[model samples]
Target: MRISLDGQVALVTGAGRGLGRAIALALAGAGAEVVSVARTPADLNSLREEGGALIRPMVADVLDASFYAQVEALERLDILVNNAGGNKPMPMVDVDDETLDRLLALNIRSVYKTAQAAARRMVAQGSGVIVNMSSQMGRVGSPRRTVYCLSKHAVEGLTKAMAVELAPNGVRVVSVAPTFVLTPMTEPMFANPDFSAFVMDRIPMKKLASVEDVANAVVFLASPAAGLITGESLAIDGGWTAQ
Candidate 1:
């Protein structure tokens, strides 16, 4: 079946590049008016040039409390893709206090705050969809990614909680958990042949998730097609999580 977000308004964080950019483009292509948020102006500009009127670029750090104000100002918001997060891979024993704090702030705190703000607006409007960006690590543990895994595990829990609380208000909350996708954020890991091969070996499909793969899933979750699908994490891991 075809999914269409015609005339819908979607807010996608981290839209400056990578999967966020892909999701923004996909949403726009699906006829949604997209509000793309990112800290980098260049990436936002690039998206605007490509998406034109359908994509409205907004430059702001998701950590900023005012960011929610900006989202609330939107005339109407139907979809929220909480995609802004980062990870600094390191062994749990070697992880510093500061690094752990930063990861928690970016991955968990920001998601909770942003979703809380969006859910408030959505409850008033009486309908909405929230897609939190998670990772395969969220479900399964990984070496040198303890902090990242913990943050995403929290995200999974938060997604379920939000879904339960918002369902009564006609708002659905879900998460998209993807295996290693080739993106600027992950190029460093893929740069090492051994590391790349090790990653590929874990995926039964022997392929990494693509930007389009995750973006398409987000679109489906946000579309009427997934009207009843909430409080769940859709794994786009190419079978990595299955292993």
Candidate 2:
């Protein structure tokens, strides 16, 4: 089915490359005029080159609360995708306070702050949808991912909290949690056979999720078809945590 957003405007964080880029394009392709924000100017330029008229690339660090406060300066945004986040391998024992701070700031805190900013605007409009990008790691724990897990677990919690509050104001909050999706950011992991095997070991499907797989879910949740859905984290993982 075609999900239409013809007169809507979408704001997607981290929209320069990787899964964020894919989602931005998908939203635009479905008819929403996209405001693609990212920290990398080169990535934003590439988005404009690739998506042409459908995407309006904005280079800004979403973690910078100041930028998000002014995001309303753009056309009234109807859809907000809190897709910006970063991760690295680190065992909990060796991770220092600074490391934890950075990880939380980039992954979890950014989602909350940005989503809150968008929610404020959405409430004013009396209609809006926000989709946060989370990781399946948020659901299950693994070695060397304690901090990452913590951040995503917070995402799930915040999604629930924000959803209930936002629902009353005509704004819905939700999340998409996926396994290791194949993207430029994860290409390095896929290059190593050991890493590849390790990741596939948990997935009953055995194949890494494609960027499109996650993008499809984002589009659906953003559409009117999912009107009744909110305060939920949709898992697109290939049954990885089912066991």
Candidate 3:
């Protein structure tokens, strides 16, 4: 069944590339006007160039608390996608204070701030959808992925809490938790044979979930098809969580 979002307005964080880019494009293709937020000018420019009138570049750090007002004023934002996050490989014990802080700020705090801001706007609008990106690691566990897993688990928690609170306002919050998507951030991990095996072995499909896989889930949650799905996390991990 084809889903369409003809009159919807959306704001997607990390829209420069990877899962974010895929989600933004999918939303637009389904007829939503998308506000693409990202830190890099070139990535945002690329989206604008490729998306034409369907996409608007919204440059702002998701970490910025004041960006909510900017976002609310700029777009109706019928849909919101929290898809920004990253952290390099590090043993849990060896991870420094600075790195941990930075990871938490970008992955966890940013998602919270953006979702909070979007929730207020959505509540006022009286109808909206918010899709937060998470990971199978959030539901399961893995070695060396401690920080990333922690950040995503927090995302899952936020989604649940916001869904319950925002449901009264007609706002639904959901999450797409994926395993080993091919994004720039994950390139190095895929290159490492041991890491790749560690990831693939647990996944029943023995393959990576594409950006499109995660993006499609985001679009579904943002659309009417998922009108009843709230505070639920849909895992696209090829059964990694099942394992």
Top-scoring candidate (lDDT): 1
RMSD for all candidates, in order, please.
Answer: 1.0, 1.2, 1.2
Query: Which stretches of candidate 2 lie above 4 Å from their native place?
Result: none
lDDT for each residue of candidate 3 in 130-235, tens digit (9 for 90 to 100): 9998988789777777898889899999999999999999999999898889878788778999888877788898889988998888888999998899999999
Clash pairs detected, candidate 3: none
Question: Candidate 2 on 1-243: residue-level lDDT in tens?
Answer: 889989899999989889999999999989999999988888888888888898988878977878777676555989999999888788778999888889889998788888878888888889999999988988999888899898999999999999998898888889999999887678987899887888989899988889999999999999999999999999988999788
**How many residue pairs of model 3 clash at the backbone?**
0
Residue 211's C-alpha lDDT in candidate 1?
Answer: 98
Candidates' C-alpha lDDT: 0.93, 0.89, 0.87
The Cα error of candidate 3 at residue 223, in Å, is 0.5
Which candidate would rank higher by lDDT, 1 or 2?
1
Between prediction 1 and prediction 2, which has the larger TM-score?
Answer: 1
The sequence of per-residue lDDT tens digits that candidate 1 reaches over residues 25-138 is 999999999999999999999899999899998999999999988787777999999999999988889999999999999999999999988988899999999999999999
